[model samples]
Target: MTLPSGKWRLGFDIGGTFTDFVLHEGTTGALTLHKRLTTPQDPSEAALAGLDEILAMQGIGPGDLSEIIHGTTLVTNAVIERTGARTGLIATEGFGDILEMGTEQRYDIYDLFLPFPEPLVPRDLRLEVPERIDASGRVLAGLDEAALERAGAELVGAGCEAVAIAFLHSYANPAHERRAAAILRSAFPDLAVSVSSDVVAGIGEYRRTATAAANAYVQPLMHRYLGRIETALAARGFAGALRLMHSAGGLIPLETARDFPVRLLESGPAGGALATGLFGRAAGLSDMISFDMGGTTAKAALIEDGQAAIAPEIEAARVRRFTRGSGLPIRTPVIEMIEIGAGGGSIAAIDEVGLLKVGPRSAGSDPGPACYGLGGTEPTVTDAALVLGYYDPGFFLGGRMALDAGAARRAVARVADPLGLSVEEAALGIHKVVVENMAAAARVHIVERGRDPRDFAMVGFGGAGPAHAVAVARALGI
Candidate 1:
């Protein structure tokens, strides 16, 4: 199969639940969409398979493909699931506990049960060398080579596959961190090393150190995944250049992504925002809100003047819901979006206090919603939507997965009967509650930035976004 030389665009998005593929003919801008189940074990398998199916259906070959814009959740999954390599941290002596100390702000001030996120590198894996760099970028004490060697030996003994070197004020000077990294690399040639100065050249020691450590934790996984994909693509008789979509809503070369995989942490969400921004432009709307409701989470982003808001830093794997400084901070460029565990597969249940609580937990795609007939016994938001007649069971996923209304009603009854409400009322209540939750999240994220939701038009996408858009908009009094 020869590659096409002109006028064709291929776009693929590997979402949490499904992988969506689009092939557009440049001349007419006609597009075709295909949906496939995402293979979490190896996402590229699904991508390659989907691409083959799309190409065959179009009777086109790889050579006919002009450009392929792709996004994936590989990096995000690595952080959330803690499936990355065993990582060690090297920091200035006496400050090795910065990650544990965090901002010293309690996410749940009144709750004694409030849990803090575990550090990416455990205490034993964390090695502190004798070094001091002040806030003014002055090296108050030089790094001790013997101390670094001892730390390196300990880390190697602790089975660390990667090491993060983050010294106090390294973002400003970086000399100590750089020297420490070189010494570690010299001792452990195969160990992946990430320096805070190279990862995040921003202020805030805790944030910088946490971001660098997170990057180190996920670097080996990302490197292997990307390397495999690149090799597979090259062997497929396609010689075109490959580019990865960044969390900042722009495409960066493969080399850049390889060096800084953290930048792709929110790449999937960024694509949705990009798609929404394009839609807003076509509709001639300037101030817009992009709402994306997928299987695991619902995300909202504010777009003003045709541009999505960008944040210099974002928190990942937070221990508490809607709480700042409760997660590992990642200092990478990303589209500013608020995400909540309020999506199609978010479990709905009654709390011990007799109050209804929606999720910060989800059924995800594996078991999915009970209505999906995929072995999920718990009632989810999608099941609630099904019981409310908001979703057509026959037409879900554009008819890829059939929904079972009977199962949905049964699941809703379990939660609603205990709440002293009828099934229909319970389903509608669940829907309303989730909508308000999403709206409230958007409100907080927007108001914090001194913006109002009323001023922004909503551009909703994802499997559940379009279904819940009007209700959320009404809740916001839009």
Candidate 2:
């Protein structure tokens, strides 16, 4: 690829704990990197702040950039934290419960008490209209426009911000779904809508509906977020093209992403995986494991033949973090990765079994770790790392931000005193526990594919990846 002279491009990723920015001068091929704690209230705050800081550090304006590529965990976090728009699902008559019914295959067949996440759309909001389409693209029953209008009215009356249209056999023939979407949009101009056929053209009643529902659930939020970023950049005199990273390790236009927000489920992780593949290939390693440990979670993906694996479908908002079917299954192409609930911001506590457990829960960037001195009292993996001398408190973010050692000690002591151990011991325990958790996830992800962890090199990314990479690799005997 030849560089366009004097042009600049920026790439940024918004993680749970931190937002990272990279400014590239296209002509000189120079790279400038910056990292800052994320703003949970409005993620774009951190993104734009980081962007301005980076550009200022390079003595350049936003208009100097020709393009900006952004990847964020907003959609994934919204689904997990249930902070997305209040969405309703409009499905074929008598099939409104497909989201709840699922595939009937338990994620853990041996475990009698299996848990699945609640549907994004509640039963009351899952309205049904008179519509049916057979598997062979034949319309068995024409769509009832009046029924759809009534359903839309009921949903809008109930304060629905977005709506999903998934009629039976819509994959074979999307006429009903399209017509229903058009009607809803025409009636409720402010409502964001997603149609199953538009989101996924493949066949699978439950999967298609779930994917569209997921898209609808986050459509409004993505729209607002992307719009905010664009407006902010334009205000800074930016005339560059803004592209969003999707879950499939590809870049898509802002409009396309907003319409199909479900594809952005693993947007951030996919970027990391793609980078891993690129760097791995550069290092002459065709087969490796990409380990990205950030604030909320650690994701591991296999890079074979210098490419990341793409899964046809991915689960979101899993009740059990590591359980395969304990989540809402959305049929969309995504970079296949195993996510472990162990990261820098992951909370640490003693489980009901009297054993120390690291999270499926994260402090995120709001209060962050206890050491951040942001009113967080809970002990997080970052606090443990600080207490164990793994991170220099005063030197954090190159002294741009300070970590409180006393706060870290106090936070770790809560767990240490209860376990009858010193604070340092407890911190070490926290660190070791998280490392093992990541190693275990990576082991399963690799071995299940008839490959050995030792055979594949481990390429680490994210804030915590490098810190725990060696320990995790050793734990996996790699």
Candidate 3:
């Protein structure tokens, strides 16, 4: 966890569409920036590639770096896309359904057909074992070691990569949970285990269980992913400390990050908010708003008196998009912000009402936007921007990659024909809809906090933020 004495420090943020880098020289205070298309298959590949390119630009070797601060959307994307490892949950007897039951509170009370996010672990994988700890930290029913072993065996046989143990009142005693975890690890050496007492250590059953389950879900993935980055860096003679950004806008050691990947749900956004606070203060502004729009999502946060607020909990994979109670709850500290699935690669389409809509779905870096000429045929916000002459087809990515205007037009035509509008008109509609969406969300976020949009300066950053910042600001009357 200690940084070596070196001249350079590196910071990088990995978003859905791109991975961005910042290299700073300690003595000279010079900064170099670089961006690369994110490799969705393995995000570490993009990170390593960008690191090499940036270091090469300055003729500096990896040994020159004293530390590397990384912020990524890995855990967040995995939860949202349901791409994490196959995980099993072990809860107290008759309480195995706590993850599904949630808080039993509706996010939207008026809607009769409201949908809830499905539990990450299916019913078949969530097994109950005989164990109970009373509220006073006393063992009411002794741990059933045999039943625990059987449940672990079943989950391992079912190909589970990780397991979560959440006994009733584990926060009070934690003895049964620790014993169960030790037994499971002894039986399955390769399995990743997360106990509620180690992950959340809280009173609420649903939140504690869900948080532990989430930690287990992403544990194996984070381990493999971090290993790749470390090995790649070490191969190039890097011996510096590697720290990860937490959701609360602070850095944590690599080991802590590995054990609690759920704490990194908003790591990238937290980085943006932190940077916004620093830059806003440098500009002598005490109150400012941060607008960061990347490839897959847009985030807005309010910084008051040079500080970003930290929330006690965060929700993810919301079934109803921005709606509060429609997502999985994870009990972890996070920088408070409003995030929406509206970004450069956000897909554009005609909804059931025949109205043009954008987002919640994205053309990620695998195929990217239609304009990327990377096999994507869907019309996205990036495609619309290119169709509306907002980008130079031949100079995109600084001419390292070229865009296909014709492909963008064809993609936009799909929705245009159905809506009886020209391609250009459809593109404009797409842009306007996205701008309005961001502005509306930002407005709500600001106003709800008893702050007026006009009172704070808006500082926008990110690949797509600058393009739409003015429009969003105008819409907000800021």
TM-scores across all candidates? 0.93, 0.97, 0.97
Which RMSD does model 2 reach against the true structure? 2.0
**Global lDDT scores for all candidate models:** 0.84, 0.90, 0.91
lDDT of 3 by residue, 1-478 (tens): 2333777999998899999999998878899988899998999999999999999988888888999999999999999999999999999999999988888888788899989888989999999999888999998899899999999999999999999999998898899999999999999999999989999988999999999999999999999999999899999999889999999988999899888999999999999899899999999998988999999989999999999999989988988888878899999999999884499999998899989999888998879998888899999999999999998989877787888999999999999999999999999999999998888888887888888999888888888888888899898888
Q: Per model, how many backbone clashes are there?
A: 5, 0, 0
- Using lDDT as the yardstick, the better of models 1 and 3 is 3
The digit string of per-residue lDDT tens for model 2 on 1-478 reads: 2235347899999998999999988667889989988988899999998999999997888878889999989999899999999999998999999999988888777888877899999999998889788999998889999999999999999999999999998888888888888888999999999988999988878888888988999999999998899889999988878999999999999889888888899999999899888998899989888989998889899999999989999988888878777888888999999886488999999988789988877888888889999999899999999998889998998788899999999998988998999999999999999998888878887889999988888888798888898889899887
**Runs in model 2 with CA error above 4 Å?**
1-6
Best by TM-score: 2
Q: On residues 115-208, what C-alpha lDDT tens digit does candidate 1 reach at each position? A: 8878889988887889887888888999899999899888989899888898888877988888888888898898888989998898898889
Off by over 4 Å in 3: 1-4
RMSD values for the candidates in order, in angstroms, are 2.3, 2.0, 2.1
TM-score of 1: 0.93
Weakest 10 consecutive residues, lDDT, candidate 2?
1-10
Clashing pairs in 3: none
